[model samples]
Target: MDALDIVMNKDKAVPYYQPIISADKQEIEGYRVSGKVKGEGEKWIDLHPFFADNSIPDDYRQEIDDHIKQVAVSKYLHENRSELLFFSLNPNLVVPENIEQFIDRLSVFKSQGLPFEKMVIELKEHQFEGDVSNLKHFVQYIQSLQVKVALDDVGTSSTQLDEIALLQPDIIKVDLHAIGNSPFPSVLTEVLHSLSSLSRKIGASLLFQNIQEFTHLNYAWRHGARYYQGSYLSKESLTFLDKKSFTQALNKDFHRFLSFEKKKIKSQIALTDTLTKRLKNYLNNNKDFSDIDQVTKEIASVLSDYSFRVYICNEEGIQQSGNALKDEKGVWQYRVEERYRNWSWRPYFLENIVRLQYEQKGMLSDLYTDIHREERIRTYSYPLNDQLYVFADIPYSYLYEKDFLL
Candidate 1:
């Protein structure tokens, strides 16, 4: 139905609950309340489009939104539910003028036996049109009432990390649908990792939505997601479901994910061991570290099957030897221009150097995109001495060939 139809029949607007499953408990932690209107043949038509449309009058949309919340809240209280009730609020509508009115409405619910602590208000910060400081104040006020705030559609378009850090919402909702549709999915891994790190630092829980398959669920689990939602686990319903509905299934899936991750870690450790053994054998046979260029080329040749490029650097991250690069035709070539380049600005450069020094062993890095190759790859770094370190770039093609390496 069109906006006019939905608006004209606003009384038909009803709340549907989508179950949110917790990663730790492997059970339904809460339900995200969404609007659905009774349409032709008494079928439930989603009101997301109507609410998302900016051209519609704010008052008209607000009326329907408020109605849905009232109905949902009454139903929740009647059922005596203890789980969290997530209500999505339009950030544009939450201005300073109407802020108190909104709080008063929540207070009315609190008077009706609904606990403020169980209420979660989800806001899409990217859609906020007014001054962010105002929105921040509104969130702070609601949180003061013991109501939790959740930033919705994070890690998507126009969601800035600075704003997230500033607002410091209690939960950050990431849309897995966006990641599945991204052209460069690998880039999103970095984005999710950053989001994950930010959430941990800020003490916010992560809720991943639109999870439609096992891969999406696994992605959410691996990226530190605390809560999960979407059709993969359960569909939105007119009534609340049993809290333990998906416990058995989630446990089975978690087992599979854990097994796969363990295999990947074992693969990385085995590769590190193999590289250390070969490097130790080569170092025992040849001791002339002064010929840096020749030494790098020899090492690259010895590990050519695993690495596409090899280089030596000092503890200060200054390249001491030229890059030994493998050509498309499998010929090894030395690029002396790369020598003397300072890599101290790179992430984990110094930390890995220190780790290598203290551990006195080889280290395998997490998967990342290589700027030069424009491909997903891993770097294996080994300490040659206190002052020098050798790094080998493992190509994406090789990792893809190995089980659980990619």
Candidate 2:
């Protein structure tokens, strides 16, 4: 079918269902409903716009005039939603001019009892190109309705992250493009797995799609995918019943995932405790210190990647020099503490550190901008046996160079 043929014909576009499974499988999580259209002698659905862009019919942009048809489509999905599972449809399929109309339709859905919550509207990664600010407002408005949003085809391009943060999607679907060759057997497992921790931090759920085999499903299950959709569950599958089956599978998968997650948290806590105690025992040896120098050496070595100079601010905001390194030997230069009121750091850490150091004696300090270095970094700090703060300068996420690069 030609591009013009699909738009003018309308009948050519059909809803193709893909199952969205929850690792917990209490019920069908949702249905990612994609539209199917025959490509020029190509059986594969033309999901993205770049395929033979030269051949696209000039008058029809995206083959779906969101400007007009969005209202009708919104009305259709809103009306037909099942309480058992969410019905996910595309938002960019709606024209920009018709966004208000779409909102109005959502209002009608709200009145009827469906609302956007049961109907997830996603935007195709390529379909969003205009003013993102306007798009954000539109998304925010939809969010106000309490309907969920998904950023379709994540990891397909660098822009996926931009849209993800801007749109604040509730779900980030892993793009099919990264799954091995568009033709070869899938082996891009490592790349797909990396996105899990990132997805978790943002409070977005990960879904692995375009998985054509059970092995791929296995990969997804092993790598933080809380949801899965593709042929292995059911080839060319499009039905509410498929949604139920997929959810059942996902529940079993997620049950195991929850167990694994708990175990990881436990292990991290145990190891952190062990490390803290060991550090304390080693530093407490009075023979090693005339002052804070011993603690400084260990901390500096642990955080050696960054060029560091430590400052201790006291109650008066004065840095006190303990003559810390006067006779202290090797590698202790990285940590030189002239005493400032050391308590300020702990109070600041207690008040500011997001994920680490909540009553834990030894943990990374909340990130603070290093006035000296003019960069953001966190100090891994623990109260030393001498009652002074022992801090190690470590770069964090904002300093991406420390992570993937170093």
Candidate 3:
């Protein structure tokens, strides 16, 4: 027999609640409904794996989805009606005819003082198949009932911005699993920033899901995640925690995170100030730094302890000097390359150059991945003269120690 048949025969489907906490408010704002089924030896089977198996029929999958939603909402209406209830449904399982059935079940709760606005129906971004415009219609129809729509598992390689724009969900829940394992942190940060900006434009709030560590929380906060959830903060349970206890531990952790970030910012400011002054003095001492070899030697001596690389470009972005890469042994090596290759096309390259033209001081760039090195780095550009500019690349490690360097 199929798993769904077994589930229905045994009446084993049940809902588990995972709390979603507000990072800014430090309170439990809502709970995501997950599913479990009774198994041998008192073990519970997670419904995710079962739902993922393609061998299951569409009707059977919908049954399981409906069961979980019904149980979650019923329990919420009877026991707790204060916080929001997030219910996820697979797009493939969503039938146009079933909308009324789902609404009828939820209307029962509405009659019992459970507000329809508190019900957030999450649609997985990665699971949606076929025409997106159809999904948009479905989402709009659902929203017409005064229920909010949430886009789930966002901020992945498969995230479709055009579809998201068209759907314009009320909330975007970014999955943090891939972000923690991602090798390209700078690119990830940029992607998150883009998602955050789009959320604001579309009037959608950003929620970071699967946040399992302090580092994940740090990234979410920096990238504009207002709501957060994961095993790190709290695990899924059959019963909900009281609002008082939920906020107490969460508030303590939030304060600690803020304190740590404040100290890190102070240290970064001090370090950058010292390095900028030393660079200014070095450049002033050797006003006629025409020779690339001598200029690199002088700068390398000052920045050797900290990780650094240096290169020079003309006003038009043609490489005028070779690369000065700092080795692990604190030794500097200059590599020759062809001139006239332009860096003007790079992001923020021209912006920093324009700033240097006006300020005439060293300009620091926002954190980014170096195309050549494939490492997180920040470039500091200084105008050596009206026609020449020196670019110093600082590895992310020595810059902020992974403390949200924007």
Best by TM-score: 1
Residue-level lDDT of model 1, residues 1-406, one tens digit each, is 8777887888888999999999999888999999999999998888898888889998878888888988999999899899999999987776778888888888888888889999999999998988999989988889998899999988876889999999999999999876664233887889989999999999999999999888888889999999999999998999998899999999999999999999999999999999999999999998879898999998998898999999999999999999999999988989999999999999998899999999999999998999988999999999998899999999999999999998
- Mind giving the per-residue lDDT tens digits that candidate 2 earns over 170-198? 77777664565332232243345446766
RMSD (Cα, Å) for all candidates, in order, is: 1.7, 8.8, 4.1
Which regions in candidate 3 have their CA more than 4 angstroms from the true location?
A: 1-12, 39-42, 50-54, 95-113, 178-194, 283-308, 314-338, 357-360, 385-388, 395-406
Q: Which stretches of candidate 2 lie over 4 Å from their true place?
A: 4-13, 23-26, 38-95, 100-117, 124-127, 140-148, 154-236, 255-270, 276-290, 294-381, 385-387, 391-406
| lDDT agreement of model 2 with the native | 0.54
| Ordered list by lDDT, greatest first | 1, 3, 2
- Candidate 1 residues lying further than 4 Å off, grouped into runs, are 1-11, 181-184
Of candidate 2, the 10-residue stretch with the lowest lDDT total is: 321-330
What digit string (tens of lDDT, one per residue) describes model 3 on residues 286-390? 888678656765676676766478777888888887777877776788776634568898766787788888988766666677787787677767787898887
In TM-score terms, candidate 1 sits at: 0.96
TM-score of each: 0.96, 0.55, 0.80
- Candidate 1, residue 18: Cα displacement in angstroms equals 0.4
What TM-score quantifies how close candidate 3 is to the native fold? 0.80
Error of 3 at 339 (Å): 3.6
